[model samples]
Target chain A: MSEFIKPTPMPRKYFTPTVIFLSVIALVGIIFVFARLIFGIGTVTNLSNQYPWGIWIGIDVAAGVALAAGGFTTAALGHIMHKEEYHLITRPALLTAMLGYTFVAMSVAIDLGRYYYIWHPLIMWNGTSVLFEVGICVMIYLTVLYIEFLPIVTERFIGRVNLPGLLKKYNNSVDKFLRALDRGLDKTMFIFIIAGVVLSCLHQSSLGTLMVIAGPKMHPLWQTPILPLLFLLSAISVGLPMVIFESVLTSRSFDLKPETPILAGLGRMIAPILFIYLSFKIGDMVIRQTFVYLTEFNTASVMFVIELVLGIIVPLRLFMSPQIQRSPLGLSIASFLVIFGVFLNRLNNFIVAYTPPYQFTPYFPSVGEIFVTAGFIAIEVLLFRAFVMIFPIVSVPQIPAVHKTKFSIRGAK
Target chain B: MANQSRRNFLKTSALIGAGLTGVSSKPAKAAPNNILDENRMGVLVDTTVCIGCRKCEWACKTAHNLSAQSIESYNDRSVFKNMRRPDDKTLTVVNEYAAKGDDQFPVDVKVQCMHCDKPACVSACIVGAFSKEKNGSVIWNGDRCIGCRYCMVACPFQVPAFEYGKAIQPEVRKCDFCFDRTKDGKLPACVEICPMEVLTYGRREELIDLAHQKISLYPDRYVNNVYGEHEVGGTSWLYLAGRDFHELQFPKLGTNPAPGVSEAIQHGIFAYFVPPIALYALFGGVMWLNKNRKQDEHKEANHE
Candidate 1:
């Protein structure tokens, strides 16, 4: 049997050519974001009154929320279902979710016209609005996510509270505080875990309901009464794939052995979830007789076809293969296709299908818009790297005492 | 008119039944003042009579405190070459459609907020920023608006336009049906300023009668249909067009209210918060059972 590995902070150089490139992109995006705030949204974006939503909403908010489903899905598997073996991946997924939601809130603030009054939804209630439901659930869910992540913070700092010179005297007290926090969080975390799952289900579906009111203005191919159900199903389906995708990428990046067994198990489960989602999606279309639009050869039809066949069908086929599940590259490719499919689905639903009448010009993201979106993504990656470096996120194999000196030398180098 | 009254009665009964069943007990909070008061005001536009003078357009701009050019510039008929929607700069616009098959004069359609009885903006605004007043005016409250622009996406007529140019406190601009003026017992700016007496302002019920009367009297002059009568569960603004409404850039819509399906789904998911609470309990129960089963297995393994 192989030796057990403990979760540990990755020991690696922080700055690389890729990091520098990402920082430059992130910096340009920050400049554009500032321009969007100081100048009007109109200044930095191609968004007109006709198209109030742009890529910030489609990619940053919708896709961001969908991709972050890894946290809850893994939590449900490891904690609720008592699948303790999957615990190795849960922390990274949690961090991803926490960061993803924080960015979602930031993106929302940037997108709002009167961004200062974003808190209005809290004090003033509109139970009837799907947006109200989405807003409230997201606000509550973000809090739950932060609460869920608190234990990780305490875990990292509990016995290692080494304050600097002047504050060194308070290190003992800080350590005591972290210990108490860790104990308290350990008992209360189940409540939060369950809440997170419920909240995710609510808002994920409500996001679909957001477009339902657009009615005839939306393309017939996407407009249906069962949109909320389809959204919830798709989100659930994407969750495991996202976890597998991130896990494989992280292992590859850090030159660690990919957790192929755990990931292969995850891959086995994905086919069924994806199949369920595909069945409902195609079922809805058939029942509504919307498949007729596929023959028309339009942007909406072409996008819908690609999003289904490439994003769902191709990955579903690949994941069903035992050889592919065991192969890291094959699993990564299949997982990526699912992630890309979901991302494209969100973009298509929010931007492509929405064709307002009397539209003088079609909306395409401007240079500034593209930069800001790319910048947000780069910042997420940078933060993820920084997080894993400081926190015990990834698990590494235990080393023997005889080899420890050599390992230490390599880590220092 | 008989059919209209019967539908109204059924609607009222349905609402009362829904309220009695505790499904939508708080109707005021459930929708934005969905009372449907009998005396609610409406405007009837006779497109056959309108000359496309653009007087109402200038008057609307002036009344809304938007800058308007001199009244003489209003005679520029060339502006009608392209269809224009009401935007932040103009709360109302007059668009000209070509006359159908040798008809002498083209039709002039005034584009503005239809102010539906079941207003989608009131139902879609995240912060309850919009309300349907007793005067049948669907108005937006800037103080409550975060300007998320969900209302813009929800409007069946595509009326709400955001002021994207404003960096701060950008307001959603739409026709409030001149709510402020009409509340003080004055006519809407467009209704008062029309030279051809094209726009008629009155109680919604009375206007429907008048619209029907005009349609029956001048069968050859006007289409039999009154746009917005039952479209999207009835709008406060009624239109009498020379031809089919779709030809004049009006979107064809079903009789069901725009927010009906969405609201139903929302309520179903969150009815008394039962489903969510039940889901929470179910998860908690499964977790408890799983934990117990795992402990039992561990104890058995220890014995072994």
Candidate 2:
């Protein structure tokens, strides 16, 4: 248990190459998006006033926010509820949340008309606006998330052993310092854990409630007063499944053991929460009778029905089956489906369902926009790999390296 | 030190519990609704008197120093070629709708900003860029606009247009109901420029009465309905489409105040102290449960 992590350090040569690669991708993305700004959406992308918001709005921000809810959800289920089973996976979930949120800032860079002027909202604050609330909460939550995930990075730094001669050349202070920092992380873990849960709850719901101010402009099929409630609930339902999917994929690709015990409990948890979310959403729609809008078979209503079926009913049913939950393939399929559902629900609200009778031209992301979005994902994956490689992301450590590396060395000899 | 503090915390737990109870049960007053102006100035457009000529639009542009959208000339045969709208550049436009009956030519339906009483655009604006003035106009000050285009998303009328091209000067452009004149007790340029006396600008109550009186006097010419009286939380601008408004692309917007739903529900649940207080207790309770359970686990491990 003490030797939870081993020092590998991916040969320092890969560091600069990786950094250079990332910087180049970011630079290209910046240049292309800047060209769009210089020329306009017409020059780069197919966005019009009709389709004012597009993939940049839906996928990058909304879905991204929902996905990042993992930070709070994992903390609440693992630490707060004292679910010892999920304790092993908590660090990775926190890491994902941090990366997901940082990407939100990246997503904002792609979406805003004047990325330079984002400071205006802060320099000249408006407390009344929902965006103001969202902006403030997300900003604060960013710090909270860093507080939550920083320990994982620090822990990895602390737990690393077998330091080579160069690292030890600076004397024993660096080693002692890292050990002290590791102890400090454990002591303050309780505070960061609480802060993570509270802040996440605030911003996850803020994202949904932010849209409530849209009034009639937001198509009736998706519009509701209790938007924050629906948004937060949907985020929680999606967060668990997201962790499940990531866990299984890593296991299969790396040829690790199945995380069945943890994954099964998670699969069972998702269906009920999803069922509740659907019940509330439908009940709210019916109680308010916004369902009346369904008679008019416009784009918004049709998409709403499709989202309800695909994102909710189908995935919910599949997740409930014990056989399905037990099988890795079935669990992966369900997990993927759950993510898709969350993605589609957000798309329906942000893009497909939003109508401005004044002038609506449906916006699809420009090629530059798509690359930027992809760039954010790539960075997230890169960060995950780096952190997991350095630290013990998986609570349950295994002997994969000793088995595989010894075989490779034998083959070489 | 930790043991002493823990003992102290436990001893005062009853007092803290009582204090928390008192702290809750109180209604929270969120920031005031700056968007709601006690008196918002508006124009009640009587659709019946509107003769299909877009003279008011021409006068509006000339007064505001604007450009032509589609109509290059007053009598340009394509005057109604495409249904023109008030967009980023143009503040006023008149759309023509033909009647189902024997009336010749088209009836002019002027389109401008509705300037709602409870303006969603104002609340949606994060920088206080938008303000519903006491004189009944929703004004936009671009000094603080971050240009997230959220105001574009929030407006019920979908009135605010983002100057997307002018990245440097990306402001929300909408009809302010000419607030520049209202502060001086002068009518807006469009209201003053109406040659046929079609648009009347006055207090909302008087305007409603005038619309009703006209409908009563000549029921045949009007639809006997004031369009904006209760539509979407009652806009300051009213309309009188002589025929059924649907014929003129006036959507079947209900009289219910839809914007209020979000504000009301959010305030109802959270504006009071019930949720946060309850949430804190729930979190504390869960934490307490975990602590006890952990102690039991330690005991079991030691015994084993």
Candidate 3:
């Protein structure tokens, strides 16, 4: 258990062609972001009063928040559900979530016309507004995510809290403080874990509620009173798949043997949750008779069918197969489908399904808008890699015990 | 390119479904506000009387201090070649629908903010940046606006246009029913400038009565429907048109208030704070269950 618990940072070269390429994209994106902030949203986005929200809200904030569900899902599974073996993936998930949310905050700033008043939702409470609820819940959940990550920061520095030169005297004191903080966090960490899961559920569904207010503006195919339920169900369903997807990708990137057995168990969890989600989706469509619109061959109908078939049904079938669940490629593919499905679903809800009354032209995101979104994703990938390289995210417990003995012998000498 | 195949697949899927027809019911209307302000102001636009002069467009810009061409230059019938909406640059636009057979003049409809009684924008604005004033105008405040633009999405009439051209300190521009002028015992800019007396400004209740009286008096001249009286829970601006309102680009909408469905669901789940508390308790129960199991596993390990 100690061997499994004591994670070590991965030893790898930081600068690769992929990293440099991603950095370039991220740099270009940052430039566009500055353009947006300085010249306003109109300059960077194709968004108008006719289509006030575009890909930034749909992809960046909505899809980003959903993809980051791995953190809370793993937290609940490992800490609150006593699935102790799942603990190995929790740290990486937490880091991903922390960075994902940080990106979300930055996206909100970039997306807002009045970026300076981003904090307005914090102080001016409109209890009736779904956006207000989403805002407050996300802010609190972000804080909770950081608090949940403090132990990881503590773990990295606790063992060797050494400082250079004159600050050496305070190193021991800092070490003592970290150790005390780590101990204190362990005792109360479950509270934050539970709070994190609850807060996530609130905002996940509240995001759906944000669209529900658009009412007539939202196409009938996507709009339903059960939208919040569907959003919550989809988020919960996609959680395990995101973890599996990230885990598989992480292993491949680092050239480690994927955690096939643990991930196989996680993969099994996806089908059942997805079944629940599909049932709600199909049932809601039937109940509302939204399926009638499916025959129209329009953009909304086409996208709706794609979201259902490619994103949900195909992934559901793949995940249900026991053999496919165990296979890394199959599991990864299935998980990617689910993630992609949720992303498409958000896009459908925010853009495709939304038809403002007076719009004469269909909205396509501007080049700046696409670049800014791509930049945020690139930034996420870069940060995740850097963090994993520096901190103890992925484990290296399989290292030979002979090195440990040699280290102790050297210390004695 | 891959998207084309996906669309084809969806088309096939759509065709595969048969005999599964079910009709969706209309969205349930939210409870109407019982305390109607009888003295609140409203405008009755008699579209049949409008001459398509576009003078209201000029007057709106001039009164709002927006750039406008000379008032006489507004007589350009060429501008009516395409339909236009009330946008940032133009507060009001007069659209020409070809008049019925043998009629000399085309149906000229003037479009602007409806200023709904139960304004969806007011309800949807997260920061309370919009409000339905006592004068029956749905007004926006730039100071409180965070530029989230949720209100623009929420407006059924889609009247609130943003100053999307501005880089800094952009505003949500809309018809405020001349809120300031109304407060000073003056008519709205467009209402005061109509040479044909196309706009009749008065109390909302009296306007409704007058609209009904006009519709009945000349049933041949009117469609017998007083628009904005019940559409989307009534708007400050009512319309009496000769042809069907839909022919003049009026959206076909239900009588229910626009914010009703969303608010019902949002407020329902969050009512009395029951669900959130219940969810927390459920998480707590799960945590407690896991704690016991963890303890049992620890005890078994200790025994070993």
Candidate 4:
């Protein structure tokens, strides 16, 4: 059996050509973001009254939230299910979720016409609104994610709070503070872990409910009463795949051996979840008699077919094969397909499936809108790289005790 | 040791569950000002009597303090060559549809917010920035709005319009039923300005009776159906049209209120917050059970 590896900060050089490219893209995106803030959403986005939402909502907010599901799913698997072997991937998943939610919140702020008044939902309650439920849940879940991440911070800094120069005198006091925080968090963590999972389930489904109010305006192929249930299931199904995708990519980027055993185990579990999601999606369509729409060759039907066959069915089949799950390249392909499917599903639900009455022109994202979304993605990638470099996130082969001691001494210095 | 920990976990979870239930059990707060007052007013739009004059458009803009061209400019009928919708700049628009069979004159339809009894905007607003006033006007509160534009998504008639160009303090624009004028005991601007008497302002209940009475009295002149009477669980604005409503660009909608399905799902998911709390407790139980099982297996291995 392969021995377990301890998570350690990657020792690779930080600024590669790819990192520099991503930074440039992120900078361009920031320029557009500022332009949007100054000139209003109308100038930067193709959003009009007929299509008030664009890629900012479909890609940045919806897909961002869906992709972040890896965090809670892993927490549930490793901690809640007591699957000790799976713990190796949990920290990276947590970090991804923390960053994912932070961006989602930021995207929402930028997308809102009155970004400054984003806090109104907290004080002014609307129990009837689906968006209100989603907003409040996301706010609470983001806080929960930050709280769950506290232990990792404490673990890194508890005994290593070496402040520089004038602040060096306070290092001992800071270390003591971190130690106390670590102890307090250790006892209360299980509650938060469970809460995190519960909150994720609530908001993920409620996100589907966001579009439900666009009755008759939405294309029949996507709209159904069980939309919330479908949203929750898809989110659950995508969770492990997202973890696998990020894990494989991280392993490649950092030149570390992939955790094939754990990833294969996760891949095996994904088949059943994807099957459940597929069955419900097809079942809902059939029950609603929406399949008749497939006979008509339109944008909605073609997009629906692509979303189902490519995103869900293909990935489902790929993951079921043990050979595919075990191979690094195969696992990456399968996981990417699943991620692509969820991403496409979000875009389809928010953009393609919506058909407003009196729409003179269909909404297409402006150049600025595309750049802003790309920038957010680039920033996310840059943050992920920076985090893994500084923190003990990715697990690598365990070093011998003597070598480990030497490494620690060098790290401290 | 495992059993002791399990018992302690269960006890703590039960306490948490009880506290959560207490939080959810407080009296349900209904959305403010949704009582549907018995004496609420309405407008009865008699489309058959309306000539293709765009006077209501000019008056609406003037009433809302929007920039309006000379009333003489309204006489230009070429604007109706293309179908138009109520938009940010114009709260109401008049469209002329060709007469169906033998009628000598074309039918003119004035479009604006239908102001449903159970308004979707009132239910869908994230901050409850919209309310159904006692006077039967479904109005938006700009002071409370965060400009999410969800109201635009929820309005069944697609009535609410947003000021997309203005970066600072952009507002949602829609027909407010002339709430400001109504409050001062004045008729709505369009109602006051209609030279044709095509629009009648009165109590909603009385208007519904008057609409049904008009259709019954002039069976040949008007369609048997009264638009908005039962559509979307009934709107405050009733209409009597010569042709089918669909011909006049009115969307065919079910009688169930626009917000019915979404609100039902929202309430069901969050009903008493019981489902989420139950899910939390169930997860706790499973975690405890799994931990105990692992602990037992480890002890057995140690014994070997």
Candidate 5:
């Protein structure tokens, strides 16, 4: 059982045309990032006082963080909730989260005007500010994520601590050190797993609390007292779908056998979570009497309708079917809808439904801003591919004789 | 060592529990000391008395040490053709709304920061970059500002303007109510320079009373309501407009304090650390329940 669960790096051609295309996009994004840093936020973004947050925030940071919920959800299920079958998906989810959060941090650094003073939130305590809570939690959770990844790092390097020339003598010490570190981490991992779940809850809800501060500035159709709960619930609902989406996509990309039964189990988990989210969403609107605004036939109303109908309702109905849950294509389609829905919900909260009073013009992301956002996602993909090639992230079901020879040649070199 | 560490953890947790209770018990005061002022200063702008002259705009720029076109250049009535807002370059702007039904002189409303009793910008700034001064001016600290512009989003009146043009040291520019001058026991730049004495600068409490008296004295001239007296839980700047304020582009907001709903929910869940601890405990219980099941799975798989 232990041997079967042990992950090994995937075997695939490293430099595919798709990888090259993504690299070009990432390179272009890097150029604009330099422009943003050297010039100003205004130079690269269409963000004004009227629209301080554009897609970089709406898509890259807010939506990025929400989509990364798979990390905690999978960890909680596999390690804490004792769902051992879900263990196979955990490492990949963690890798995605670590990379996703790193980029989220980088995006924030680019977005901030005083990017150098990004650490001020740590020292400056403003408990009342939701952003303060979010900043602190994200900072701490990122550290926890790195700590969680240490065992994986140890696993990769423990026995293969070879060094060239004069450094060869130090290999034995390095190997021993890694083994000790791995042993220590294995015993104490549960504490960090618990903290990760707690920290995730804090920030997910606080992101919603951030929009609540906008108050009358946000359209009534989206505003509610229970926004934090809705945000948390929605994050949880989208968690398993994101895991399934990544797993199915990876399976197709690497030409590995798809874990159909496990993915189908994940599909079942999505329904009840989505149902809870919808109930609260509808209940909040009904109680606040904000449902009337849905009839206004404005941008906010139309956006709300589309967000629920396409993002949640249709996906929820689809996921309930046994046939849809069992097929990789059906699971991917349903999960994509969930991802799109949550992304739209975040976009609605930050940009679509927000109207600054006495504004002359509406805001749209500039070419540079769009490029930078695309670049962040592209970099995440490139990094994910690079790391999986170097480390044992994705499980290799079978190691062919040819592959073993190739691995030994590479190791010897 | 283990016993001492356990005791330490328990002690710290108790202290945190006490502190959280303190925060939730007085949710209104969770806003910070800058929000509370017994005798904060204010301004009452009688728009009915204001002529279309733009001298106050020039004075504000000059007093703030911002570059201004000559005072005479501001007198060009053509500038009022388009309604303008207080931008990064300009701290105050006068917009002329044509009076309803046969009036020659346009209603000129001077616009700037309302400096709410509970300033949302102050509350929203994550790094504590903004604060409501004791003199009732919401001021920005450039060094502390990360330029998240959460303040700009949070402001109901949309007063905070960012320096989008500058590549370096861009600031959130807004009317500071001439806080520096007021600290020196002098009037605000615009209030001191008003030729018609249309701007009355005084304590917030006295100004509200004065606003009501003027509204009653000239019942035919001004609206009965003092625009900013109770809006967004009152503001330092009170307004007496001849027409509805919405006509002048002032956002129609409820009397609720801007941070009320956000703070309530944020404080409610975090209060006494009840929800977080309970959530942790719940997860721990789940871990416990599934512990045996996981071991059983491992054993069964090994047997296979």
Candidate 6:
């Protein structure tokens, strides 16, 4: 038993590289951000009123919400469906969501024209706008996520071992209180879980609606009234797979036990959702007769076909094979492909496919834009590492030992 | 393009169908086509008499205190390749037209806000940034503009442009039909500035008659149809052209108004406050049921 079940404390050393890399990237991004602010948007980004939104819209809002889709998916199966087998994977999905949203909030700060006046949208009233609804929903959802992560933060910052003199006394009560609070949180999660799912459904779709008003300026291949539905479905399709990919990577890096079977099961469930997405996506195209454009190889036409093939069909086919799902490297690659596909599809919608029919220049995200995007990702990671270290996020049994298991020793989560 | 258009038309109907499906059980009947109220005001532009000189564009810029275009002094020789549309800096532009079968081939169109009676920009705006005044002007207020640039996107003419350069003081700028001029009972800056007595501002009924009169007078030169007469549910500023209107970059669109289709759909779905209210109730009920189910499971486990 001793030979099979040796344990090691969380190492402080492995975190250095991640910290150093993020700091270097963030410093570079901060400089470019100032260039954008001081010299005006025209100086930095290729964005025109013709394409007022560029990479920020695509990467920050569209992809951000889609990445954040894991939380709702996890909540759906784990909490509402009452599946205890998947409980260990919930914290990882929640971590992904928290980071995804924090990045989004940062993106919003950088993207807004009158950055200060963003509060006006919140403070003022406009009942009819889908944007207003989305804004309110996302804000409420963000607040709920922090509350969701509250136990983790408390555990990290207020541990009995970490707490110094007087506060450390009656550590048993503190431990008891934390456990009870954690259980209470689990008990009361139905409302937030449901709200998160629905709000995600609304806002992800509403992001499509944001561009719907661009009458003739947008290319016909991208613009459709069913945009909201397409966006919502695509977000879910991308999100479920993302959770599996992220969970495995984090587990491996942290030297934790594998959550492969549960994650693979989740990946299998996403297959049908992807099918629905593919059906609607293709059905919309075929019905619109955009398939004819596949024969004609213009920039717009090629982009339209490429977006469909890479973002949809390829990822769908890759994930279907049970053989590939078992291979960690294969699963990771497939996950990366799906994520990239979703991100590219959004960039296509927000930038590539968007056009001012009256003939204006195109828009692309600048170097500064890229940095801001990276910084958000970094902040989320930093927060995640902090959360996992302090909280009971990884189930204790899942941590992998450096020595091979004599009797099936579990690995890191 | 023809086959694609037919497919698009089919998709448009499908969209209308999909929109209706999400709403109430009752099937949607077509609203009355005879619902147009023709008492609205308009402007009349005579393309034949108009010289290529851009007096109206200059006057509009000066009146609005907008940035003067360098293309004005340089002309189309160097900058037609770098052609610009109405933007935050330039509120209006006069594209030089040298029509065939003429010595100089000199004709110009002074383009600005069309001041649509049923404006798409107004409907597209979530906040009341753009509004249709009763006195026949589509006015804009900077205070309420979210800088979402929906107005820029919604304008079929590509008229509204954003102040993307100013991070703090950005606002959407366009010709507001020179609402300030109309309020003081004066002609719009463009109309007042026209050197050739080509552009006319008056009640829409009077303008339609004037357009017809010019088209009749120069049956050889002028096209019979008034450009803005039935475009996008009718605009206050009308146009009479020598060649086809679309040749001059005028977008060919439906007379039914763009906003009418989108708003009616949004309103029908959002009307009676059904969607959000129903969604909230359903969520609340599910949460309550879920809480009880978890408790029941807990009790069963304890008993075991």
* Two-chain DockQ for each candidate model: 0.60, 0.29, 0.31, 0.52, 0.50, 0.19
lDDT of 5 by residue, B1-304 (tens): 4874576466445545655665433322333347467789899999988997889999999999999999899889998889898989999999888767775457899999999998888877887778787778888877678888888888999889998766667789999989889888999999999999889999899999998888889898887889998899999999998887888788999999998888777778777667778888888788767887766766998899
The Cα local distance difference test for each model comes to 0.87, 0.70, 0.83, 0.87, 0.85, 0.68
Fraction of native contacts (fnat) of each candidate: 0.78, 0.42, 0.63, 0.70, 0.69, 0.24
Could you list the CA RMSD of all candidates, in the order they appear? 6.0, 8.8, 10.8, 7.4, 6.1, 8.7
Better of 1 and 6 by lDDT: 1
lDDT of 1 by residue, B1-304 (tens): 4874576466556656765686743333543455678799899999989999999989999999999999999999999888899998998999998875774688899989998999998888887789888888999988789989999989988899989888998899999999888868888999998999999998999999999999899898888999989999999999998788988889888999989999999888888778888889988888889888878986998899
- Candidate 1 all-Cα RMSD: 6.0
TM-score of each: 0.94, 0.83, 0.92, 0.94, 0.93, 0.83
Among incorrect, acceptable, medium and high, the docking class of model 6 is incorrect
Model 2 chain A is weakest, by summed lDDT over 10 consecutive residues, at A404-413
Please, what's the RMSD in Å of model 4? 7.4
Off by over 4 Å in 6: A1-11, A154-187, A396-413, B1-40, B67-82, B102-104, B260-273, B280-304
lDDT of 3 by residue, A1-413 (tens): 22432456887998989999999999999999988878888888899878988999889998888888888888888777867677777888889899998888888877777888998865444556778778888899999999988887887898788899999999989999998998888788878888899889889998888888787888998998888888888888888888888888888899987878789989988899999999999999988988889989888888999999999999999999988987999999999999999989988988998998888888999999999999999999999999998887885445544332111100001
Model 1 DockQ (Cα-based): 0.60
Candidates 3 and 6 compared by DockQ, better number: 3
Clashing pairs in 3: none
- lDDT of predicted model 6: 0.68
Please give the TM-score that candidate 1 achieves against the real structure. 0.94
Error of 1 at A315 (Å): 0.8
Instruction: State the displacement of the C-alpha of residue A288, model 2, in Å, after optimal TM-score superposition.
Output: 6.0
- lDDT by residue for model 2 (B1-304), tens: 4874575355345334544576522111121224454445568887667775677777677666677454347645366767776767777778777656675546778888887777777766666677666677878876656667777777666667666566455556778787776667777888987878888888887888888998899888788788888887688899886777778876566666644655565455445546645665677688668968877976998899
lDDT of 3 by residue, B1-304 (tens): 3774575355334433311231111111111111247688899999999999888999899888999989889988998899999988888899999967885569999999998888888777776677676678878878778888888888889888888767677888888888888879899999999999999999999999999999889989899899999999999899999999998889988899888877887777676566777888998998798778777877998999
- Model 3: CAPRI class: acceptable
